[model samples]
Target: MLRLSRLTDYATAALGWMAERPERIVSVADIAQALHLEAATVAKVLRALVQAGVVESFRGATGGYRLSRPPAQINLVTIVEALEGPLGMTDCAAGAACEHALHCGVSAPWQRISAVVAATLSRMSLADLARPVAQRRHKEIA
Candidate 1:
């Protein structure tokens, strides 16, 4: 089955929360407490986010993290790539050294599928996810 890692899931949850209040600088501890996740895990995720240019890191007193850009500019593709490197449905699709890539008939199809998946993810932004699930469900119902 296709699945993202736990860290990627945590990344989405953490970024979604921060996106709700983009102006506020948040600590890992605060995010962990607010999201009911482990602080250590959140810290690692935030560090990766900072390196990915998704979040800005601050130092010294009152130091924390803040969104590097508006939530609308931060798409899921960027987030996924940040945590998981590249988005690849298959090893060959990700540019891995597959010995059979030259002769593999499925390589083209997998690459196409990967592109479609990436395009879909690129369309979704952190702002879209920042909304509370209940509100989104209510809107869907309406």
Candidate 2:
């Protein structure tokens, strides 16, 4: 039952929208309107992204937000971590102390699985998410 939070999902959608128009400075209101999400939610997501250095914010009247780097340079791992803190399949996998740590034999396996998940996410860049399905498949096939 592993899943991303609703806010994280919105953040990805917002980021993907921006990635498609990387050269544009997009207002939060516009993003909210386009994504049919609440303005406050979009603002919150943008603030987190800005704090994480995933997106840069402009503070002028005509200012808005844009990605801090190219889509290809930003991976899902970075985005997920930025939105969700860190990817961990279990408490121990995230380095938290567990009451059963001494007796836990599955901890090592959980850590390994977490590492593989992290690596898979790292390999998937924002550019991949931004592209059309056909384009992504073509790239994967080539």
Each candidate: what lDDT? 0.91, 0.91
Which residue runs does candidate 2 get wrong by more than 4 Å? 133-142
What would you estimate as the lDDT of candidate 1?
0.91
Clashing pairs in 1: none
The candidate that achieves the highest TM-score relative to the unseen native structure: 1
Q: In candidate 2, list every pair of residues with a backbone clash.
A: none
| TM-score: model 2 vs. ground truth | 0.91
| TM, every model | 0.92, 0.91
Model 1 Cα shift for residue 45 (angstroms): 0.3
